[model samples]
Target chain A: MYRQDEVKEASFFDTGEGLVFSYGPQHPGTGHFRLIVRVIGDTVLSAEPDPGFVHRGEEKLCEYKTWITNIPHLERPAILDAAGMLYPYCLAVEKLMGVEPPLRARYIRPIVAELNRIGSHFYYFALYGVFLGLTTPFMWAFGDREFVVDLVQFIGGQRITHSYFVPGGVRNDVPKRVPSGLVKQFRAWYRDATGRSPSSDELTDDFQKYVLRVMEFLDARLDHYWDLMLNNALFMDRTVNVGKLTAEEAAKLGVVGVTLRATGIKRDVRIDEPYDAYGEFKFDVPVRTEGDSYARAVVAFEEMRQSIRIITQAVEGLPDGPVKNKQHPVNIRVPAGEAIARAEAAHGESVYYVRSDGTDRPYRVRMLTASFRNLIVIPYLSRGAKLAEIPAIYWSQNVWPVEWDR
Target chain B: MSESKIGYIVNELKQALGESIKEVKIDKKMTKITVEKDALVRAASVLKGLGFDHVKGVTGIDLIALKPPEDSFEVMYHAGSYSVQELANIIVTIATRIPRNNPEVPSLTSIWPSCEYHERETYEMFGIIFSGHPNLKRLLLPEWWSDAPPLRKDYRPPGR
Candidate 1:
């Protein structure tokens, strides 16, 4: 990725050493992160990851904002999976305040979370396709992800940055009726794409019927994803043995999500701790024995199927009741205590350690994102691999730059 | 069942560290173990031996913000397990206090290689030096950063 003349004019290149190539704080693959790769010929000797190009000092800002208001700001780092990002924070705050969200809210939390998970995985596949130079999957993935995002918006009112989860419960209940506009839009799209008018049952305004249809559609789409990206000859050849990580190495480095799951370790926070409705829902934590780029993609793709299963279970099992606990007010001061909560975000396990001083604002909030935990593996795995395979290994770990930077 | 597991780990920690163990807070959610500053590495070794194979997060809290200033910084290492299934759900926070004037602690990267990046981020965020860190230079912060650690209680962001 480095040009000859560009290397010649660079000051760091003047130092007597092997070729030290800085691969993007600007490149499409890196996305606001840089990797300084010191390579001898085509083999990478060591790859030093340079992160924090998008650091927003979110922890510092948390102290200033009220607990409720912080929800909007905290969800920004991993906007694609907004509900997942805020899940732990909301849990921690609720723990400190000593209030539990009602049963209905608990069910809704996971339903929306799995929707975001599906959306986020599609986004990953979209970008992963581009990184592997397959544009067809990119277009197909982003286009497919809209359906999942639409389901989330039906619940949370907004598309991407849904500040839906709060301390005691969600901001609002799932709509009793899906908006007529959304129904017409889906109807029109179905008619245009399939060249036939959709059935009234498929485009019904009933929340349960409509969301289930979307999930069924996405569940069927996973087969095409497997065919297009996961099982493709080029994808398999490029990623199969590239950046192999043993289970021992993965545990030692403390990587999570598909990266750890690919190594055959069944370590998921949702199953381990069983927060919220995760305890009620029965879903498999997908695993693959071969710890390679290909295995990671397979694990991620498999997770989408499991997410759909969880969402279906949640929707079917959702009990009718109050969504929010009215006792906890908007500006409620939390009792002085420290609590740590963990959630299985799309990237991996995101942990939030919150310390409250019996004040409206938090004394300190430490967010350990999944991407930050996996950042260690970038430098570790990139060693001894061909320079061209860097993107495959990097994106395989699912290191979202902004999520880690915050 | 999980509570007893946490109790077992807490007992092991207390027995291993003995006089060095300052406080142990055990709950269903987390088990926080505070140890002496000098005995940090020994505590980490005991934890690793107890099957806490990796560090989850390294957090620094400035206690000066409290009503009567404590004038010290608390660094906590949130450790978890993958090999030990019973201990997998637990987060054992091994914490120690360092003087605000001269905050220094031995790096635990030698014990748990996963602490490498966490320690580096802690160093830059709170200016707590990890003495034996392989690379203790700036991580998240820019190379040209010349201000007090932004996370410190006294170091307010400009225009605040």
Candidate 2:
């Protein structure tokens, strides 16, 4: 609620117990962004994330580019979840133009969207594993992600920035063999990886082996990132109860995705709104009422499971039809109007508002990304959290800074 | 609400604000209303009474080609109601044209607090001042940015 200009005295705090530290922009573990943290007595007092270091003026850039050209630009915000980011923009444009995508196209859109969701969630799980001091899980998650990326490359000719979703339908149909092939590959991979449940001893041994190997790797490359980073007893002590955003506080701030689901709000725009063939699929929206860092992590894990279920159902009901609408490309002229489209991105509910003046280009394009909305909760949540726990809290929130700054 | 009901809502909004309601267009996609520059606050007030509580987004577009002699800027306030859900999900965008020389419009932040950031963004990108806004500083632009409004048609980036 405080104005940026009114806030003064930006400095790290040491609460007479210990030295306060600042980690960001230059820190490898801090992701591709910067944040200033205030710590006192090995506990974080406040943390302010400084975004926009990578802002490329995408929104303003969209104004000049053709409607078709902006698709690639939009995907850069959250490349891992490209479909979820761009589908809403396509929907908004289609809505403004009064053009209904063919039924076949709608079904295909969701299929690709679910595939992207799986890829994105896997990537998140991989990053989360790395953040939580687990290396094997990170390698496993990322290695599995390559399978989905292969599918995307086969379908869209690009791994990360897939500009497949256009105004009326997808850019092209899903490759005939890729869907079944990927499903089989994923099943095999999962079966071979987590199939046989390990005993407690085996699990402990695996954990220790991963810790040692990861420690060696980190020790050789990045000294700052040690096995003790997130696993240290003091680290857990610092993060356990800090940044506690109850369900009420989370809802009040309109936090979404893992942040809101962590608070036990059974709301997923895909399930609730049921856009792009989601209505026919069966899935559950994960919810945890605790609204803590652990709760957020649990929610993300549960949601990943739910997303896997959705992908399974989508593959099972994969209808045989042309994925792209057959209409002539140049003949498409959206009627003069406006439309708002929302989709459940990996971060949260990402909304796109498109205003069309019956032209090939949009008159106005406004995107309310989930990270931007979730960023508001940082100031509120960081009020009492210890400094040492800042990274854990931030990672648990699952924020993508590019999406916020964009 | 039926199409007729939506029409009635638009007509009622027009009646509430006489000359302020410059243009009212109801299309298949959305219902749009353009108010006079000075009447934006009143138009927003009237729309709120009609059940548009949430300000979905405050969008601005550069219309150099469509600029009139007196006004060269256009701004829109898109608002809707989530309570009514289906029947009332219709968004009514109140657009207004302001003089490019001194583009200024009454801030709706007093009415919709969420519009605070959105308006600040518009001010940063379009250089449209939202008079009476509680905090009018730039939201996305750096404090030392010297570039013209980035979203404007004539403001070209250095290399571009």
**lDDT (tens digit, per residue) of candidate 2 on B27-90:** 6555678888777888787776765655656778777743232347888876755334443335
Clashes of each: 0, 5
Interface RMSD value for candidate 1, one decimal? 3.5
Any runs in candidate 2 off by more than 4 Å, and if so which? A3-23, A27-31, A38-46, A132-136, A178-190, A194-240, A246-248, A328-332, B1-28, B31-56, B67-72, B77-97, B106-113, B131-135
Q: Between which residue pairs do clashes occur in model 2? A: A25-A34, A43-A386, A43-A387, A44-A386, A44-A387
List, residue by residue over A1-406, the lDDT tens digit for candidate 2. 4444423222234334544455666643533566666655555555656666677788777766778878888988888889988988988887776677777777767766766776776666566656656566567667656766776687677997888888888887765444444443444443354444333332232322222222222223212222333344544554456567775555335566788777765667776556778888887888877777767766765665566566656655667766666666644666766677778787877878776666766767788887776766665566555554566677778778778678
Candidate 1 local Cα displacement, residue A45, angstroms? 1.3
Question: Which predicted model would earn the best TM-score?
Answer: 1
DockQ of 1: 0.58
TM-score of each: 0.95, 0.77
Per-model i-RMS: 3.5, 3.5
For each candidate, C-alpha RMSD in Å? 4.4, 8.2
TM-score of 1: 0.95
- State each model's TM-score restricted to chain B: 0.96, 0.90
